[model samples]
Target: MNSKIYFDGSIMTAELIGEIDHHSAKNARMEIDALIQQKKPAELRLDFSGISFMDSSGIGLIMGRYRMMLLYGGVLRVVNVPHDLERIMILSGLGALDIFERQGEVYECT
Candidate 1:
């Protein structure tokens, strides 16, 4: 997977692309964690709009980031998740966390 991070005030948005799996989660985690540690933003938004595929590793990725953000008293928001992946995430109990958010035309998990 590949990602691009943007900063808007105290909110840092990470746009994840491609596939998220065992092979890519580590690098993505490292990159995102580095920035989170360096900037300590008030919010971390994980944009999954560009993602095409994901596995259990994706769940781990999100959970890990959520924990990291909590350590710094930051909120973690997952947005723009595709329909298929959204179901998977919800089934994994991520939806229950109330972290999924709406972004413009993107559907918000309820």
Candidate 2:
């Protein structure tokens, strides 16, 4: 999998591409975590629109990032999740995490 990260003010957006599985999860997590630490953004927006497949490792990835963001008093938001992936997220209890359908909008955490 590939990822592109950009910042919108204090929000760090990671646009993920390709498939997310055990093979790619570690590297992807490291890359995204480094960027997040560098930016120290108030939110981490994970855009999964370009992802065609994702397995359980994907769930771990999101959860890891979610916890990391919380350490900085930030939040994680998942965007543009596909139907199939959404099921996996739900089954994995990732649905309990903050998720959204739109990209590029600003989110303020209270």
Give per-model CA RMSD: 1.8, 4.0
Q: What digit string (tens of lDDT, one per residue) describes model 1 on residues 1-110?
A: 89999999999999999999999999999999999999999999999999999998999999999999999999999888887797778668776677887665434444
lDDT of 2 by residue, 43-93 (tens): 898999999999999989988998999998898888877766767777786
Best by lDDT: 1
Name the 10 consecutive residues with the lowest summed lDDT in model 2: 101-110
Give per-residue lDDT, candidate 1, residue 86.
72
Off-target runs (Cα >4 Å) in candidate 2 are 100-110
Top-TM-score structure, candidate number: 1
